[model samples]
Target: MIEKQSLPSAPILIESIRSIGYSFETAIADLIDNSISAKATRIDILSIPNEEPYIIIFDNGNGMNKVELEEAMRLGSKNPNEVREENDLGRFGLGLKSASLSQCRNLTVVSKKDGKLSAFSWNLDYVIERNSWSILEYSEEEIMQLENIELFKDVETGTYVLLKKFDKIQASTLEINKTITEKMSSTIDHLALVFHRYLDDGVEIYVNNRKIESIDPFLTKNKATQAKRTQEIKIGESIIKVKPYILPHYNKLSEDDLKKVGGKEDLRKNQGFYIYRNKRLIIWGTWFRLSRQDELSKLARVMVEIPNSLDDVWGIDIKKSTANIPDIIKKNLYSCIEESVFTSKEVYRYRGRKENNSEKYNYVWDRIKTRDGYEYRINRDLPQIQLLSKNFDKDVLIEFERLLKNIEKSFPTNTVYLDVADGKLKNDSEMSAEEIDELIMAFEDSLNKCQELGLNVIEFYEQIIKTEPYCNNEKLKELMKEKIKKYE
Candidate 1:
């Protein structure tokens, strides 16, 4: 037989709830979910720079009446097991209270409906002193006296979540206003991404009077971004939509496009899956253990869409920032990942050369996969390489093949990958006049080698011009043709 025990003290429980691992961004995001669920078209986030720092999130949403406001303020007001509306962004009803108290000691809510206003507050200090789950309800006149209430006069029906005594943010800070401003900027980007679909659907969000713009991870607007095939998977009763995208090679992007997708983070780090629940981006830039992130696959990004019904199936956490891929869907996801990486690698290896000269040129190196693993070998099928092998002596051909293999074996791919990630790699497309001269010299050297091997000059010149590195430089190819005319 079990003995019944009394509940924990209100202060102790509130303290535990407030420390439940919420970053400032996610906490603010959870509150925004409430506004979105209320069908808010316009939401404003304000970080008032008073001596005592406070934050106000005001939304022009359908306001709650006195009873609904009381129910909304209560902890665990809605059971997670209960079926909610299809578009509701909330699960557990603890978001309003828990998210606000996570960052502040005092949480006050003022709501207006049909020309009547009601207010309620949860003060941790007051609850701790009283040793009970006590709430302070303010009169309409008292609510009007609040610091930011003057800004909410125009809204006839809406809700204001005012956070005061910002113990988490303002603690031990001399420049509190600057810290809040920085936090608001982060909030701006987080909301822009999380509520991007809603923003596209006419929902407006403003941070300190500045409008927030969506950051589309797919780069769908860019011409060079290749949209690959999409596959649909059914797990039990849920259907998951998967669309894979290979972003443009960095060289194909303009400076503005580079900054758009690249931002401060390396573009390589931005590869992998972007998980969305009901069109809201929850987690992104993850491979979910399907594959490793590498230089060749840096351009690959897959978008996975799941409905709220699959929350439990996907293992969505309270923070909504992480999700685990289900075993039932892993097989299909892996297949898609393989195809995406292959496409990404083609773009990465040739760097748009294949697109421009698809039928004319063959790369110097071929990527070979065997039971042993991946290896690189020189492409002996290139006409120039084959012609030289046929005309040259056996010893010379053997030496040349050995040199090619050694160069391929000793290629510092790992170091090059690190350099690419660190943004240390220079743009190969932009060639100075001196670089062009160097390219012409390399082309002339190849021509001279073919002649010394007793190959027909015209045939060798035509073959070499269509080969890798040379095929990519049309200007150098034309100049080399001029030099070959001089040889004749």
Candidate 2:
């Protein structure tokens, strides 16, 4: 018996995987990968805003021939593991199709190579309706028209991709254009950072006519800052380098300045471990649970570089924009992440009032005499107290007397003795004085101790005296009155 092999079904939209789930940023990154693979020295991303604003990515590279262009349209056609030139940035070949289709319904690629030009278009709606792998071939007139397009006019050899029918662009009514510009600006800044060496080598990237600038995630531009430290581990034949970074303290960054460092406020966005495949960024967040401490959030810009060979090890997906860090990497990452967290915490240790030694304690001393001149006096000794009365206002004196009576009732003399025996008094009170002279001397000594310990002392005495605490014993009243009279 003879058996027939069935042909593969035409590609269909996986109803489970709606195109909306893929962010516009990821789609753009995927298109840029193709540009890099074509050996494009210069790339221009133009955003045309009309009824249907389209995105155009033009690159001056070794353009594709008719056959190559046809093959490129086929999804999942290229071998991901095949070795290519060092500069090639393609892997799994699905990026062009997946990335483009994920954003818009129409994707058109026009190219010129070896004096011949060709074009191809894939419309998701057309494909879904026809249920076939049909592409629009470039007619002579169409090819001629595309040649005059400004993006390709001066190019000796290159390719251009136009994404139209943008169904995926975010629609926010508040400053929509400004929002898009800011997002693209930040995305380009990051892309440039990821490919700084490439851009430095005479390759230019422009976003809406403005040149994209490279921003070092490590802030290496500051000559005084320490250089980023790198740790490398061998996963099979490929060497994965983890560059850990400790950002400057919060106070060191100015308000307007931190805003320039995209997503600086969010801890999740701040400390990042960018994953690169084939010299292109595949991931730009944390490596799962490798680092999740609140303190480590500030050091959120660390990047991890992985060669293309280890894409499988990293579980890189077809879109080349997301990946899973393997157990091998996870194990190595734990130590590197812990060390980074420790360093970041140490740097920001003095962040708030925790470092203010002077305000740690405040003491206030007040001496007052009554109008009757009965000679009764009051001496208050407390640690870290803020004195509310200097002249001893009647209302403040009443509140003080109420607080003292409450303390005496709730915490009797026996309780105080127990507290002192248990060492709790060390935290609650200063030294105790029995006789009136002794109490005065002790209060002065405690004030000196507070000063010695670098505490704030606010003295409020000899301002005003109204009534004095009544004591039955004549001897005690005389001593108190004498002390009050001396201070007054």
TM-score of each: 0.75, 0.66
Model 2 TM-score, 2 decimals? 0.66
lDDT by residue (tens digit), candidate 1, 110-145:
888888788899999999999999998898779879
Candidate 2 global lDDT: 0.62
- The alpha-carbon lDDT assigned to residue 177 of candidate 1 equals 84
Clashing residue pairs in candidate 1, if any? none
Residue 36's lDDT within candidate 2 is 79
C-alpha RMSD in Å of predicted model 2 compared with the true structure = 14.8
Model 1: how far is 83 from its true place, Å?
1.4
